[model samples]
Target: MRKLKKCLLVFISSLAIVLISYGVLFYFNFFQEFVTVKDNKVQWNNLPDDTFKSCYAPKLSFSSMPVTEISQTSINLLGNPVNNIKVLEKAQRYYIPLKSICTVLGFSLVKNNSEFILTKDNMNYILSNTDCIINGQSYSLRGNLIFYENKEYISISDIEYIFNLVADFDMNNKVISLLTPLSNSNKSENELTDGKVALIRLEDFSAESVLLSESGQMKFKIIGNYLNSQGIKYHIAWVPRYKSPSNNIDNDLLSNISIENVGFINTLDYLINHGGQVGLHGYSHQAGNNTSISGIELSHKYNSSEEATRSVLENAIDTASALNIPCTFFESPHYKATSKQKEVIKEYFQYLYEPNSILTFHKIQRENNNLFIPTPLGYVDNLDVSSIEKGLAHPTPGELASLFYHPYKELNFINFSKENFGVKVDYSSSSPLQQIVTSINRYNYRTIHVSDLKN
Candidate 1:
């Protein structure tokens, strides 16, 4: 009996030792494996010492690549870290299942390429090697085929394309719909004829934005030259009352301009002398955002103000009298006009630049018995190719290029004297406007300003 007890104790001690060793190995992730597969061959990179420092093993598994695969150029459904390739060359390019690759890299299938590149901010990524090279450094990857099911595959270009679609999200208030060409529409009976496009501007309410202001001037000059070169007529979005009190370059430009300049005394004189027009933007260009405005809404929406709320019209009329220009046209600041504001605005001005919220001219009469022509204006807040493309792709055709813009590097009386910086105001480079100009010139487009209408 003594001998038997000693043997049993020895066996128990051996079992305990084995269990302890297994536990320690598992804790250090010594069993963890990294996987990589290519051309029917599977390879793995050994896990780093830190991967399994705890008790849990990483969940590693694989899923079969179902669809047919093509050459290395073909995208694998499993996407990046592709471990397998199933060749099916005849499949339509769109049907290639490369969700993994597309989802990882944000690209689309507009064109074909051997390898796709991802560039965001300053980071650069190359998908072929399953390596993330950032700032000239490579980070080793641990997994093979980024396994999903019992089967493993690579992502590569296929996944990159899908991600491209996701990143190109469209979020904006603008909508495009086809309408009859201007030639088919009835002309406006007023001084400013209907069907004639107009160029309107928002007075940069902030005085601190001088860079933006100079930028705006450069934009204005560019647009003006384009219109003039094309022989297209246009009108300026001027607020005489908003002019700087100083006799600076801005004032001189305003005083010498031939089109409608928004203001009080000088505007009235210009209108009287040049057979020009006067429009009401707002008193002090108003103040507010989506809500909180005390004035007649220039947009089609109704306002809650007594003068549509703030008696904005009363203030506007008073300002006009003070400045000497009769307010005949109404435009919303930032294009945020309300219904009540519209009704009240009509009491002061004879016409209003149509708001985009109204889909068609027919829709305008349904909203208000008055005439609201659809005069679309391009709203540019920044210098970009996309913005310029929008202007050209959808110009008013034969009407004015009523482009609305704001340029202010800083508000106040200074900064306009500074050079336009390195930013090319003219279309000497690959500017969209230049592209449009080249296109229109090639096609022979005749441009005209709104004030040039014969009505």
Candidate 2:
């Protein structure tokens, strides 16, 4: 009986030891699955299989389209999975080549011959460095192969190279990538850092008028104060003077002699004297659609059908020269800009402020690499201030709000009779200007000025 008991004890002890060893080995070999969401799309781990599942199907816009299957492992990234897939498909269908996934995610890419790096989730990755220490791993340069009907094909070697270089990486520190388009590298270093831009601009001052009214000058003063407080750097643009349709309305006959009378030449002098900038605001606040003046005449004040567009731009340059402030930035009158207007402006102004955006007031121009900053001012007819108030209350990141008003609007409403401008009408509910001020304070918003732009 004693011998049998001893044998049983030994057997039990051996079994326990074997079990513990197996557990440790399994733990060491296992990899936990993780999900990544980016660009409004989701991706799940198929690290072992190279397969991805779509977390959500798109709202089919085309009839007879193939049904998309959803995979349980898929993730929802950037809150818009449907749009993300569409962008991916567009890239594939159009054969439009791109470098890294980071670009699609709206982040820049960087690399070094010896080390590969990227920044995502505010965390940085550096591969092929001693810190990563994956030199001994048998990493393979696998392409982004798309498999259809059991056959695979791929040509995106750059992406494959990045994956191979970092496949064995154990992220420990953060780093910024240095790779970028050649044109982007030419931008001032300060402009690229922090990825923030500041603009200073003026409205409606012209070559003919020199006075800074409370409405016009006050706006710039407030902007300067805000920018100084924020410790932000900025560029400035000058308002050029031109003849408006209402320009000929004699001051004596004009009932609303607002500063739309302010000429561009005078506007430039004031901006320069007041530590503001001088940029083109067209020769005149020209309006109208396809019949509008071309770029050359718009800039230089010359009427030429042979070079109507170029003439507008030349006139603008001439006007700028006349004001003693050369300008390459333009803001359309009253946000009334058409699509081709930019192509016209691009001939002279490197930056353009036009009225063609749904969300952003300022946008980086898509083609020219020149800043296509939209002046984010919304049109307020006083009745719709409530909706505007709500949006201001919950402003998005990088949101910019510009308030443009004809000083004459106030003058006309008040009927001060400063000048016999025209027949006047009136209403109550506080002026749109007053509502704008109240909303700004309520939202605790930062006000940017037209004159505070960076040249």
Tens digit of per-residue lDDT, candidate 1, span 1-455: 99999999999999999889867854443233312223322222321121112111212111221334344333222223323434231111112233333343443322125333555555555543234443565532211123233323433212222121100000121111111111101122222112222333333322122212323333333333333444333333344233332323233221232111211122122112222244556544433332212332344444455444345555555544433333445566656766666655554443455553433321122122233433433544344435444554564222223344442311121121212111222234344344444543443333332222212
Which runs in model 1 stand beyond 4 Å of their true positions? 1-232, 239-278, 288-303, 308-310, 325-328, 356-358, 361-370, 373-377, 385-403, 407-455
CA-lDDT, candidates in order: 0.34, 0.36
Which candidate gets the maximum TM-score versus the true structure? 2
Candidate 2 at residue 197, lDDT? 25
The TM-scores of all predictions, comma-separated, are 0.35, 0.36
RMSD of each: 35.0, 31.7
Question: How many clashing pairs in candidate 1?
Answer: 86
> Lowest summed lDDT over 10 consecutive residues: which window, candidate 1?
166-175
TM-score of model 2 vs. true structure:
0.36
Cα lDDT for residue 257, model 2? 22
